[model samples]
Target: MKLLIGNKCYSSWSLRAWLLMRAAGIAFTEELVPLDTPDFKETVFAAAPGSGGTVPVLVDGGIAVWETLAIVEYLHERFPESGIWPRDPAARAHARAAANEMHAGFTALRGACPMNLGKRFGPRDRGPGVARDVERLAALWGQARERFGAGGPFLYGAFCAADAMFAPVVTRLDTYGIAVDPLSRDYMQAVLAHPAFREWLTAALAEPAIVAQDEVDEPALVDLRKS
Candidate 1:
C-alpha cells in the first residue's frame, strides 16, 4: 500500500487518513507532497488515478482510492479484523452517518479554524458562524460520549471511523484554543493523546514547508506546538 499525503502541518484530511491507517495497524509507504506549490498538481496527477490532484490519495495494490472516506472504506474492507467500523449493524450505520456529516458539513468551522496543529489563538475575535459551529460540535461530542463512549474515551469507543473523522476537528479546536465543557475537553484530550496523532504532530512540527498564505490567515500570536 502507498499513501500519498500533503504537508503534515496543514493538510487536515491527510492527517485523518494517516491516523486511521496507523490506528488500524496497516503498514504502508508514505509519500508527502507539498500542497499549493507549482509542482503540486503535476505530482498529484502523476500519482493519482485521475486529474483531480487531490491530497490523501491511497494506492492499494492496483486500486486507487481518492476521497478520505472512500480510502477509509477500502482499508476497512482490506483489513476487516482491524474493526475500522463497528460490528453491530446499527452502530455501524450511526458511525457512517456521523462520518458523512463531518465530511460534508461544518464548512464554517473548517473555514475559520483551519487545522494548524497546536496553534493557539484567542477565541474572542471569532465570527458568529464559527461560534455556532463550536456550539454544534460540543453538542455532538457530548451526545456521542454519553451514548456510545461507555467502552472508552472515543466517540464510538475503541476508536472507530467516527473518531477518525473528527480527529482533524479536534486539532482545529486545539489550534484555535476553543474552550468546551468537560465532556468535549476529555474527548479532545483522547484525540490528542492518541499515538497516531502524536506521530502526526511530531512530523508536522519538523516540516519546514511553510505556506505563507496560511500563516498570514492565522492569528499573529499563535503558537504551533504539539499538544
Candidate 2:
C-alpha cells in the first residue's frame, strides 16, 4: 500500500487518513506531496487518477481510494480484525455516526481553525459560528467519553476509526487554544500524546514548504520547526 498525502502541517484530511493507518499498525509506504505547488495538481492526478485534485489518496495493490471516510471504510472492510471500528455492534454504529458527522459537518469550526501542526498562535476572539461549533463538539465528546469511552482515553476508548476521524479536530482546537469542557480537554490531551500523532507532528515540523494561505494566525507566532 502507498499513501499519498499533502503537506503535513496544513492538510487535515491527509492527517486523518495517515493517523488511522499508522495507529492500526498498517505496513505501508508514504508519499508526501507539498501542497499549493505549481505542479501539485499534476502530482495528485498522476499519483491518484481517481482523486479529483484532492488528497489523502490510499493506493492498495492496484486500487486507488480517495476521500478520507471512504479510505477509512475500505481499510476497515479489508482488515476486519484491525478493529478500525468498535467491536460491539451498537458501539460501532455510534462511532460511525460520529465519524460521518465529522466528515460532513463542523464547517464553522473547520473554517476557523484549520490544522497547522508547525505553527502556534495566541487565542483569538471566537466568532459565534465557531463558538457554537466548539460547544457542540465539546458536548458530543463529553457525552461519548462518559457513555462509551470508559476503557481508555479515546472516543471509543481504544483509538478506533472514530478517534482518527476526529484527530484533526483535536489538533485544530489545540492550535487555536480553544477552550473546551474538562472531559473534552482530557480526550484532546490523550490524542495529542499518542505516538502516531507525535510522529506526524514531527514530520510536519520538518517540512520546509510554507503555503501562505494556510498561515491564518499571525499573533505571536512560533514555528514548531524549531521546537
Candidate 3:
C-alpha cells in the first residue's frame, strides 16, 4: 500500500488517515508532498493513483481510494481483523456516523483552527465563529466519552474510526489552547499520547515547509468561557 500525504503540520485530513493506518497496524509506504508549492498540484497528480488531486490518497494494491473516509473504509474492509470500526453492528454504525459528521461538518472550527503542530497560541484570538465551534466540539466530545468511551479513552472505545476522525481536532484544541472540561482534556491527552500522533508531531516539528497563510497565532486562554 502507498499513502500520499501533505505536510504533517498543516494537513489535518492526512493526519486522520495516517493515524488510522498506524492504529490498524497497516504497514504502508508514505509519500509526503508539501502543499501550496508551485509544483504541488502536479506532484499530487503524479503521485495520486486516481483522478482527484488530493493528499491522503491511498493506493491499495491496484485500487485507489481518494477521500480520507473512503481510504479508512477500504482499510477496514480489506483488514477485518484490524478492527478499524467496532465489532458490533450498532457500534460500527455510530462510529461511521461520527466519522462522516467530522468529515463534512465543523467548517468553522477547521477554518479558524487550521492544524499547525509546531505552533502554539492563545485562545482569545479565536473569534466568535471559532468559539462557537469549540463549544460544539466540547459538547460532542463529552457526549461521546460518556456514551461509548467506557472500554477505553477514545470516542468509540479502543481507538476506532471515530477517534481517528477527531484526532486532528485534538491537535487543533491543543495548538490553540482551547479550554475543555476534564473528560475532554483526558480524551485529548489520549490522542496526543498515541504513538502515531507522537510520530506525526515529531515530523511536523521538523518540517521546513511553512505556509504563511497558516502561521497565524491564536490568542492564549486564561479561563474557560461559558457557552
Candidate lDDT scores, in order, read 0.83, 0.88, 0.81
Off by over 4 Å in 2: none
What lDDT does candidate 3 reach at residue 22?
A: 90
Write candidate 1's Cα lDDT for 15-97 as tens digits: 88999989889899899988889998788777774848898899877788888999889988899989799877777787898
Which segments of candidate 1 are over 4 A away from where they belong?
216-218, 225-227
Better of 2 and 3 by TM-score: 2
lDDT for residue 64 in candidate 3, whole number 0-100:
72
lDDT of 3 at 71: 85
Best by TM-score: 2
Cand. 3 TM to true fold: 0.91
> What is the per-residue lDDT of model 2 for residues 46-156, given as tens digits with 9 covering 90 to 100?
877857878989999879898999999999999998979999887889899999999999999888777888877778877999999888898788777877888898988
* Model 3 spans with C-alpha error above 4 angstroms: 217-227
Error at 147, model 2, angstroms: 1.6
Question: Which digits, one per residue and each the tens of the lDDT, describe model 3 over residues 1-227?
Answer: 99889988789889999998898898999988888888877877775545578888887776778888888889888999998998878778877887888899888878887877776767556678888877877888787777777888887689877888999889888878788878888989999999988888787777777786876644433212111
